[model samples]
Target: MAKAYWVATYRSVTDPDKLAAYAKLSGPAINAAGGRILARGLPSQVYELGLEQRTVLIEFDSVEQARAAHDSSAYQEALALLEGGAERDIRIIEGI
Candidate 1:
């Protein structure tokens, strides 16, 4: 199976504390589920019609593993902490 990637774009961040908490908890959860952070940072540049947003890319061994990471209890806890703290667009895609 092709690898899977978790792509997340932070549209807005309202609570830095919650964001920090989520990051701390989610890291170990993702690692336990076989996910690796590929890239994470504010976009260095944007093209036409682009909106400024922080982007994150995480790779997983497979689509199933990616899904598992998202559904894991540790990640879920982080998600709860992040609720209403930010607006984010997150997805998992199969790598080519």
Candidate 2:
């Protein structure tokens, strides 16, 4: 089965308190959907200029599985906690 890789980048955070809550909620949501958090944050070089405060890398069994994890009701419940929590950009790509 082909795995799916997800790279989540955060643009801005207006609410850290809410993000903490969302993180906790999402943890279980992702686990339940058969997803593994490969990495959450790793120090990255800043050659030019970029906001590299937060980044998440996750993997799933397949692209469909990744989509299912993100689109599930459990994750939706988790996302609800982030209504005004933080701003984010997420991308899921089929990997080798």
| Candidate 2 structure quality by residue, lDDT tens digits, 1-96 | 789997888777799888888999998999899999988863466456766768899999999999999999999999999888788889999988
Candidate 2 regions exceeding 4 Å error are 47-50
Q: Which candidate achieves the best lDDT against the true structure? A: 1
Candidate 1 residue pairs in backbone clash: none
lDDT of 1 at 63: 90
Candidate 1, residues 1-96, lDDT tens digits: the string is 999999999999999899998899888888888999989989889999987899999999999999989998888988898988899999999999
- Please report, in order, the local distance difference test score of every candidate based on alpha carbons: 0.92, 0.87
Q: Per-candidate TM vs. native?
A: 0.95, 0.90
lDDT of 2: 0.87
Instruction: Point out where model 1 deviates above 4 Å.
Output: none
Per candidate, the number of residue pairs that clash is: 0, 0
> Which candidate tops TM-score?
1
RMSD to true structure for each model, in Å: 0.8, 1.6
